[model samples]
Target: MLHLVTGHAGFIGFHTACRLLERGDGVIGLDNLNDYYDPALKQARLAALQALATRTGGFYRDVRANLADAAAVDAVFAQHRIERVINLAAQAGVRYSLQNPRAYVESNISGFVNLLEACRHHGVGHLSYASTSSVYGASTALPYSEHVAADHPLQFYAATKRANELMAHAYSHLYRLPTTGLRFFTVYGPWGRPDMAPFLFTRAILEGRPIQLFNHGRHSRDFTYVGDIVEGVLRASDRPAAPDPAWTSAAPDPARSNAPWRVYNLGASAPVALVDFIDALEAAIGKPAIRELAPLQPGDVPDTAADTTGLQADVGYAPATPLREGVQRFVDWYRGFYKV
Candidate 1:
């Protein structure tokens, strides 16, 4: 199958595309390579993908364009027989959204709608896009389930992701499109984004700088590994959503609908405290971090956990990498990549 992956230069997108290529699937990677983090890192990932294609003898195509450009997105669909699409392109970051709401709207909302339009027009079999755990904002729900109400989002970033789910549902209902929205928790691993906690903490520790511990080290996250996430993504892509026969409007489940729409939480299910994560990182790096406790930032959740039952039941897989092991792998990659 020929799969189209948006944000192919991104951390998750790069890993997903590489895995697809390793499995001998035709892949068309699309990314604007925005400087949300380091475009150099993104470029390196793209180069790795190209090298992998040559090594594995996989069909790989690269498209450099912004998803928000209607003409660009349409041209991609026009040029390729894209059977499935994994939309990971977004202006991601919780706190960054505070300063740049317009960026979120332009990339996450507008860009997503453009892809949906192309998918609907091109008769794409399945469409899987990234949502976020932040959508469960202000809810003290433990191990958030797909059935839980997630109408309240704390940040503009989370709100955009929630809007994608709604927008996807509307498209699915109106056009019978098979759509799957993945609510990703804290994903961390090698080639990860620098904005995330893992990279920030690692860099700070290596540089002998103080690592900021938000919520006074009380915050917890379901830090999933990127490799596990890739497994779930491919499985979800293979299984196109179908209308739920059990769906009823009286007490409708937030996860499934009468339309061919479904949502699943992808996470490790293991919520580790901020302090514990720091300890793991320190162990991996062979050094202790200088900690600076700080109050929680605006729109920051104190804790997040994923129920992942729906994902496991549907795709027969869930994120399983332990925190210590995953952190070690990331640290090794960091040391090698940056020669630290």
Candidate 2:
């Protein structure tokens, strides 16, 4: 089977693409390689994919274009029989959204609509896009479930992702397009984003710099491993969503629709506290961290947990990597990748 994986050089995207290629599936990787964190890291990931594809004799093609460019997006669809799509491309980063909301609209909102249109027209079987746990903003509920209404989003990034889910639902209803929105909880593992806490804390500890503990070291996150996430993505992509026959407008479920649309939380379902997470990192890196406490930043949540019951039911699995084990693997890769 051939697949189009947007943002294939991204942390999760890189892993997902590698897995697909490893399994002997043809892959078309599309990435803008923006300087979101560091294009160097993305480039390294791209080079790695190139080498792996060559070594494994797996079909691989890389396309460099922004999804916001409708012409570029259409050209891709016109060129290839992209059977499945994994939409991981987005202007990610919660804090940055405050400074530049337009970037979010251009990429997250517009780019997504472009993909939806292409999928609707091209008869793509399934499109699984990235969503986030931040959509459950201002809700004190523990282990956020997809069934509940996520009407309050604290940041523009979350709002855009929520919009993607809603927009996908419309296409599913009208055109019978199959779509899945994965609401990932604090994913941390090898090739993780530098802006996230795992990378920041790991870098700071190794460099003897102080790592700031947001929410005064009390924040907890369901830090799912990248490998586990990739597994879940593949499973979901292989299974097209079906209309929930029991769904009704009068008593609607936000996660399931009468259309061929569904949303599931892809997480470990095990939240680790910040202090404990740092401790695990220190142990893995064999170095002590200089700790600093800081107040919670805007658009930041004190805690986040995922209700992965729906994910397990649909995909037949959930994230299961242990925190210490995953952190160790990340540190090992960091040392090798950066020679630190």
Candidate 3:
């Protein structure tokens, strides 16, 4: 399979691309490699991908460009015979969305439309994109299910992702495009984002710095490991969405469509409390964090858990990596990578 994986240098994207390459699939990676966090980390991930491609004898092309650039996106499609698209690109931070709403609009909304247009014109067989469990905002639902109405987004970041879902549905309905939206819960593992809790907590603990605990460390998250996520992504992408036979317009299901569109929540289906997760990190790293408990920041949720049954039923998605083991792996990677 030949895939166009946007944001291929990102944490999940890097891992996803690597898995596809290892399986002998051609991957065309598109990433602007912006300095949203650290460009060096993105570069390192790109370097790793290049090395993997060389070692595995898989076709891999790194294209440095932003999705917001329509000409650039169209040019890529014009150049490559892309069959599938895995969109992992977006301005990802919730708090950052609050501070710079324009960035979200540009990257998440405008850039997404560009890709959608390209897919529609290029006759792409399947399009799988990253959504978020945060789309279950304002709904104090314990297990975030795809069938539930996710119209209310608490933050700009989530709103943009929800907009992507709606946009995909429109394209799917109008053009008969096959689209799958994977709503990810809190994801953590090796090469995870530095801005996320696991990386932040690990780095702070290693440096003996204070680690901020939001919502007074009371929130729980269904933290899925990267390997499991990549597996789910590939499986769902391999099975392009089709018009749900059980779908009805009279009473629509938010997760399925009369069109070739489907949405599923991807996670471990097990939520761990923030403090307990911290304890796991401490155990993995052999260090204690200088904890600084604080109120939940704006645009942040108190708790998040995923109802992963939708993906399970559709694509046999089962995320079984235990939290402790995943944390240990991440800690080991962090220490080795940073020479800590």
Backbone clashes (count) for model 1: 0
Return model 1's CA RMSD, one decimal. 0.7
Tens-digit lDDT string for candidate 2 (1-340): 9999999999999999999999999999999999878999999999999999999999999999999999899999999999999999999999999999999999999999999999989999999999999999999899899999998999999999999999999999999999999998888899999998899988888899998987888899888999999988999999999999999999999999999999999999999888999989999999999999999999998999989899898879766688999999999999988899
Q: Model 1: per-residue lDDT, tens digit, 59-168? A: 99999999999999999999999999999899999999999899999999899989999999999999999999999998987989889889889999999999999999
Q: What are the TM-scores, per candidate, against the unseen true structure?
A: 0.99, 0.99, 0.99
lDDT of 3: 0.94
Given candidate 1, what's the lDDT at residue 82? 92
Q: Show the lowest summed lDDT stretch of 10 residues, model 3.
A: 139-148
lDDT of each: 0.94, 0.93, 0.94
lDDT of 1 at 124: 98
Tens-digit per-residue lDDT, 172-248, candidate 3 = 99999999999988999999999888998898999999999989989999989999999999999999999988899
